[model samples]
Target chain A: MSIKDCLGIQDEELVKKSLENIDYFACIYERYEKKLIRYILRISSFSYHEAEEVLQEAFVRVWRNLNEFDESLKFSSWVYRIVHNTTITEWRKTQSKGKDRKQDIDDELYKNLPSNLNIEKELGRKIDADGIKRVLDLMPEKYRSVLILKFLEEKDYNEISDILKKPTGTVGTLINRAKKSFNQIADKENITFTV
Target chain B: MENSQKLLDKIQKENIEQRKKSEFAAKNIFFWTMFTLSVLIGGLATSVLIFAFGQTEFDLLSHITHSRVELFLGMLPIVWIFFSFVFLAASIALLRKTKKGYKYSPVLVLMGNLIMSLILGTVIYFSGGAVKIESIFAKNVPGYQSVEEKKTAIWSAPEDGFLSGTIISVENEVILQDWNGKDWKIDTKDALIRGRVSMRIGEEVKIIGEMSSEGLFKASEIRPWKGQGNGANHVNN
Candidate 1:
């Protein structure tokens, strides 16, 4: 039988199972760590830190509430939805303040990445990865998430759609748009696109 | 090359520091709780003996109220906690005022505590009539025991796994509504409900759902519809 038959299990029962059989669930996290963290980072302003914390929280939540999961919806999709909800909640905290304050933090985080990047001039003149990261950091959360899933995590269009709970077609469009946005920044920075 | 390498090295160092910082979380706060508990039990026993045998004055009213509350509703964890603290403080204060040649000694104090507690216990034990509060939302319904939930599903497993019950109609993602039965919502999440849905008919598939607080079953996990008593283990789905 598929997993959906196990839906309505008790939290205590799941916790007991998790405690007894750590490998069953631990394997899930170990396999998906990079993709999950990148997905969370794309959703949050504090990508690295928030992503780590939220990923850990999401795993703990899954571990603690395993018995609560329904098998009808794919487990990966359900877990991604929870991460999406967590990101939205975190975004709301920053968004709750006045618009000006929100925009201010946004601009600070989304500024021209290469301008801030200190690629030394005298000794070496090389295209820096950090500089590229800074520019990628500027794209809006939705677009950035798609880009990371496409390039970094190497998730396909349908998988990205499932992760973000967006329509598959929209995921495809956003990925194209995200590439365009990244290109614009790269062109403006005078960084030669190798490919 | 030197500056670029230094910058990368610095970022790497910073990332390592951040990861290490995350690792050193706040220590578990429950470790030292038992030490405090031992002191409390000892102090209570000492004070009871002192009050019963004649070392101090015993407030009979306080004893009665405490006994009543405890008997009526088992003392809450927090309430018992504050109580332990109060007793500990009072015992410390009483012992501090050690007096010589006093008529009320530990012997008399001990006797008073025992007699007062004994009397309060007797009064409370006889009053079995529970104080019932009329809930506006819960109009005279039966207790939690009256809540019953039934789920039916037929599922097939191409692979080997334990099978539960079959789901009829799922009301909510978490709450299960029978095809024609009473429905309730389950609060908890993460369950399995399995059945094939071709948009034609509902299958009698296997289900494993939890009974919820609102007297409804939630269906999260489900397998393809199939019969039970096969090879795999099964719970009522």
Candidate 2:
């Protein structure tokens, strides 16, 4: 038999096997470390505090419920869904607090990022933190989520679909609409996104 | 002119740094893995236990039985998906560092041990794991039984050949280990690599080598687990 046939079913046995194999979790942890952090950072607006808090909460949920994973669904999709949910919850709380969720001037997550955020690369003009936040706040939550997952987190449409639990095509269409919505906000703010 | 050049360089550096911060970190990866592990294990454990323990009339496999909770906890590489959260919650609780913490600490520790036992049960289950380690090891070993006992591997590979099922293990970033019922040692030199598990802390692998192959394949993929060495880019812990 081919190597494929050699393994048992991806059914209950597989699930059981995974739990007994604690290192399996480590294998999984390696897969999405960067993308998730990036997503969390973007949603949390580079707020190390909020991102750290959300990270713990999110992982706690994931670790505690690892077995709940449905094999048929793509793992990344399920993962993104977790991060998205965790991040959204975090983001919402931050929004509710109505405080600037900025990282400390010298947090390690900044990787030696300068005291001044370089928003100037925009269309040869500086896009200050205030400007970006203004536009981001004005954007609908749905639109903002899409944009962040797409651009900031670098997730594809299908992944975004899974994360958002929407249809693949719907995610694609919404991303387009989201971009448009972002532009509208930028226009209203009199801030060119490129700027 | 020099001062202007310095200013521009600093701005550029600041921008790059800003972008990096907005990018990602290790903690992010830790949590993602933790969550996936929990959800996958929890959901799968529940599913399998429901099936394995619920009503398996496999006849010969009767000894391979336990309560649903036991069965669920008994397969694969064991870890308590449910209890980690409880501990984390307790960690938060303990953060208060009050008499309340003293009161709740024992309960948290008990839960931790409970999870440990539950995970260990799965470990024992895989040793044939369905019934008990002595029984399972007495007869045969399943490639993937939840880890219940510390000494047992959640899965087993005889390092030679197998009877059925494919095993998967990630070798060097370029080679993918393939297991097909046959027990075999994965020689990284001859393997077809897939994605990398780690580039820094050497490699973290479970050596039931055969079944862990993640499904057997003729090594053909180029640069299998070869990561962009992204972890190196991050500030390593």
Candidate 3:
């Protein structure tokens, strides 16, 4: 199929075609490349270069395990799941090697956070993007990941559940707790939110 | 876009092949088989646990000790209960490894496992499977005690006004061999025989009486060794 045709086809269809022809796999990689790199950077201490490496490895794994993919799950969720696992494994490897990688969220990405988070109502003061970023960085990885997936990535509960391989109820609970934790960290840091 | 092309080019150069669908199918089948086996084992354990509880003489707690807690603790069947929960947890963990297993909450999974075990266990218990399995374990497994053996131990305290034995003879004076193979002459003339008390030879019986002398037991009441074998209660006056 042509590049235009591949772009028009759905992810599930692309996955089926990719199995028959390796070239079709390029469309799958291209489709998720940008979004997944951003996801890896948000959830891990990886730099852009390292995140790209992880994404590349993750896509290769996705290719090898294509037949194992459950047809019932959304293709986007499956790809995200692979990316999440791959990033976490790499993160652990870096930690064990005593590499102290600084987690940095892009300032531009922070500015794009949705306003519906109701952080202003919870903190009783208007909080800026930088203040939110600080609170998120200080939170535990589990809570931080859930918040990023839910609020920043604009993923629903079901999507988060599929990506994390957690129950939807657990996903909801995690998001609520993550928000509470984020607020607590904000309060503890005593960041002066501009009114 | 550059990295994407790089990956695609690498995939073509290396000729990376997708894993066969049968591998995933086999892995899924293995997990499901293990999950089912765990549940079935758990159910069987539950059945044995129920049977053990059923065989216990809870009514005789008053006779054993003043504290109900002591009697309860003594007859709790800890081994069977442990095995049941161990297998239950195993089943739950195995189920969670399946593709769609994470969709269900832990509470829901636990409840589902418990219900399946209870239903399967009850069926097995009623079908007498529990009794046969219990007996086999008691005989083969070292340090494993059956409910019947436990009951015998409870009722074998001749000095404490309880004695149980197989009847050697049931004539003017009952000749019985206690669980420890000691012979005793039981005087049941003034005894109240409760339930379906079969005073036939080789029949096992429990006597609530004191050791009058060396090999003699003066009986006040007699009961079938198994359960309160319900029938017409009689007096051997």
Candidate 4:
């Protein structure tokens, strides 16, 4: 049976098994590849190729540093942190090269956002996907990252803090600021939902 | 999907190495060691500055006998205090860089640095290293004399002035090494000697006196200087 076929196995348990048999590590790569690609794409505005390169580097780092992973943290959070750092480093290098990637909002990510989240309601109206994308791109990186992690990735404050390497209170503050900025931007742009 | 498979195959082909737990622990140990050393050095620096302040001849109570606020403000050790704050900031920055530093809030980390400095300061005080370090700074660091000189000028004023110094000699009169290391001849014939009134060479004494034209200090009273707060009542000139 494929490792993916093994249901109910926690990521932590997978890490322990992968420590003994390196081949089992492929399971971790398989599980997180798409999610990480999406996250890196959204955060760094990387094209799929650039995102793939970052993903490969991030997985390599995780594989080499597996033993250094603290069991106290969720394995997913730890993996995402490595990916986050690697992507930011890649993003900086890309910036230095004066290459800009169109920050095309992934339809899957946009669709996956919870319908009940206030990003739409707070505008006192609904914004189309293009309006939402424009508002997100206009905001500062700090606020944009928090909004993506909160609404897009659906991470709670603690997990967001772990991934961002910030305190939970700081994460809360960033979310509040992001929401306010989003409301103002949407209002300024006059986004209205069509039936 | 094929690309994901290739990445997995790459991991298997490379035989990626897992970092040793000892190495992880070593990194943590190294960060903590640097943090602790920073705090200790910062604390010792703070204690040294405090000791220099303590060794000053500016008697707060006596200076208050003039204009309280001006004297207090003038005698404030602004330079040493600035140094203390700089050391504190360095310690806090090091603490934040530690591996588990982010686990504590910034305020908690700052308070931790302060408490560490306080504890280390007390230890340095008891070990008598504070005074030694203070003297070293005074001699070696530039502008060290400026703060001290201002304090001595305020303390050694000529009229109704107060001075505390080590008695260099005591024959018919007392020769003192004053706070600024200058010699002062005190005429104690008309003075009231208080507080276990025994005179000896090398003992510290506080004298309240008038400055004669001959540049000798005519004492109205002399009291044994029993460190701080012991001879406040003796300033009777």
Candidate 5:
């Protein structure tokens, strides 16, 4: 069996093994590589090359600071936080250089995300991924990130709070505001959904 | 795929250059030591304010009930509180740079700083750290003394109030260095002296009087300074 299947273990256990033998870290990288790329693509104004750079930088930081990885937090949330910070920093650097790059949602990645979203159920309509993407592109970065994390990634409010480094209450408030913003932007863009 | 290989190579190389166990521990120790020192200093500042609040002869709780806005807001120790707050802010700012700090929200971090300062302040206050700090400021720091003097002059007004200080001279007339650091001549002819407290030179006394002139005060009542940090009573024999 490969290292990935060597042990059908928890991420935390994988992290523990990785700390001792650096080669074991490849398991973690393999697990989150695609999801993180898609996350960076959705939230950050980085080209594919820049997003790849951010992903590499983020994994590097994760590997270097694995010992500091808090056992209390989920390994996925910790990795997401590292990636989120790296992407934002890279985005800001490019922003200062007056280079604005916007990335579209990858079709394959979008298809792979969780489909049984409560947002569709709540809206009482079938909202296609293209329409959601259009609304997200029109919304501000803060609102967009919250909505994507809640709807697409299907993360709970507390997990989103941990990933975004915000208070749980603030995360709830942001999710509410993000939904309102999404609906308002969709209405303005003349996008229709059967209610 | 190729990029992951490249990053793996870099990670392995960087891991080799990572500091040793002792060095890492030393860095963390240095950070924690600095954090602790700043917190203690902040606590000391808070202790000084707590001590000052405790030194009041008047019933502060009564004032809160009867003239709360006037007493609580007007007489709040803004200077000492400001210093304590600044120190606390410094402590929290320092803590935010620590390894586990980013885990807390800013409000939670601030609340933690405040609570730690209050607990530390209470500890210092009960352990007499506040008294030592007051004396240290009074003797060593001239600037601190001047600010304290101004505060005393305003709060402990001679009109409808009293002055507490050590007796500087006791010839035919009484001369004392008032709490405001100014010398005053006390006309003590008809003053009622209470307690078995003596009239020795350098003995602390609380004199209730009105400022008669610029540099003179008339005594109505005289009593021994009978609280913490005050000299013990020596009955006149």
Candidate 6:
């Protein structure tokens, strides 16, 4: 089928086709590749190259475990879960190797953050994207990941819970705590907002 | 698009196969089975614990020299309690590993397991399954003492005003052989028999009375060996 036809097909249906023929798997891969890579970059200190590597590995795992995926869950959530785990595992391996990893937030991605985050109302000033990135870098990994999933990815609590393998209540709590932590870190850093 | 093409080419180059659906199904079934078994075993432990507490004669602590606190502490079935908690933890861990198990909060999961075990335990206890299981364990398992055995041991102290034995004869003075095979002459003229206790020959009885002399015990009250008799009828002599 053409790309237009594939675009119209749902992810769950695509998974069945992908399982039968490897060529159909390309459609699933193309659908999630960019989003998954952006998610990896947001949640970790991975470079574009490293994020691409992680996404590739994660998609391969998704292919191998296609039959294991539960139909009840949104296919995107399952893919995100695999990508999240893969990113974390890869990050841990790099840390163990004593690699000096640095946070690399894309300027384009950061520019979109303020619109999604209602922080301007609370701060009474327009906080810049760099300040948000700095505060996210300063925050703990658990809190940072939750914030990235909530604000950056625009995922709801149930979706976040599915991806993180946490209860919906715990996901809500984590997101609240993450936002609070972010404000506290921003305050500590004394980030000057452009009014 | 280029990366996707490259990955697709790599997939074609390498013979990577999707894992069978049956494999995931087996894993899910295994986790669910283990979780259910853990809860069931936990319930059994709880039932046995209830039975142990039920058979404990807390009211008879007044007759013994030891304090009530000491007797109560000594009577606690630590092994059964430990088993119950172990099974509970196992069930919780196994459940968390299952699909959608992480959807529940830890407190909710813990309470759910505990309440389920309690409900199952109460049913088992009321159905008399616990007693039968305890009896089997006591007779067959080495060093394993049933609640009845523990009760018998607690009541076997003659000097402390507690004695239990099988009645050899019911005469003017009863001849009773204690658990240790030693015979005792019990004076029952002023004794008050509690519950529906039969003073017939070969009947096991628990007496709350002091040792008057060697091999002789003065009985203040007599009760059946099984339990603190539910019957309030006091046969006074």
Q: Which candidate achieves the best DockQ against the true structure? A: 3
- For residue A57, model 5's alpha carbon misses the true position, in angstroms, by 2.4
**Could you tell me the lDDT of residue B143 within candidate 6?**
91
Clashing pairs in 3: none
- Model 5 residue A94 CA deviation (Å) reads 1.3
10 residues in a row with least lDDT, candidate 2 chain A: A113-122
Off by over 4 Å in 2: A1-18, A101-134, A193-195, B1-237
Output the number of the TM-score-best candidate: 3
lDDT of 2 at B231: 30
> TM-score for chain A of every candidate model?
0.57, 0.67, 0.89, 0.87, 0.86, 0.91
lDDT of 6 at B38: 99
Docking class of 1: incorrect
Error of 5 at A80 (Å): 1.9
For model 6 chain B, where is the 10-residue window of minimal lDDT? B228-237
Give the TM-score of chain A in candidate 1.
0.57
Q: Can you rank all candidates by DockQ, best first? A: 3, 6, 4, 5, 2, 1
lDDT of each: 0.43, 0.45, 0.85, 0.73, 0.72, 0.85
Tell me the TM-score of each prediction against the true structure.
Answer: 0.31, 0.35, 0.88, 0.78, 0.70, 0.86
TM-score of chain B of each: 0.20, 0.20, 0.81, 0.64, 0.56, 0.83
lDDT per residue as tens, model 4, B72-165: 6666766657766777787677656665565566777788788888788878977998867767777898867554466455556656467767
lDDT tens string, model 1, B1-237?
Answer: 332233224434553221221222211122223323434453443333222223111221132323445322322223323444555444433432322112233445445444543443334323421111112112464541100111121111111121232233444433333444434443324543222321112444333344443445444444444322234433323
Let me know the DockQ for model 6: 0.74
lDDT tens digits by residue: candidate 3, B89-116? 9999999998788999999999999999
What interface RMSD, in Å and to 1 decimal, does model 3 have?
1.1
Worst 10 residues of 6 chain A by lDDT: A116-125
TM-score of chain B, candidate 5? 0.56
Evaluated at residue A103, the lDDT of candidate 5 is 53
Model 5, position B160, has a per-residue lDDT of 43
DockQ scores of all models, one per candidate: 0.01, 0.01, 0.76, 0.50, 0.28, 0.74
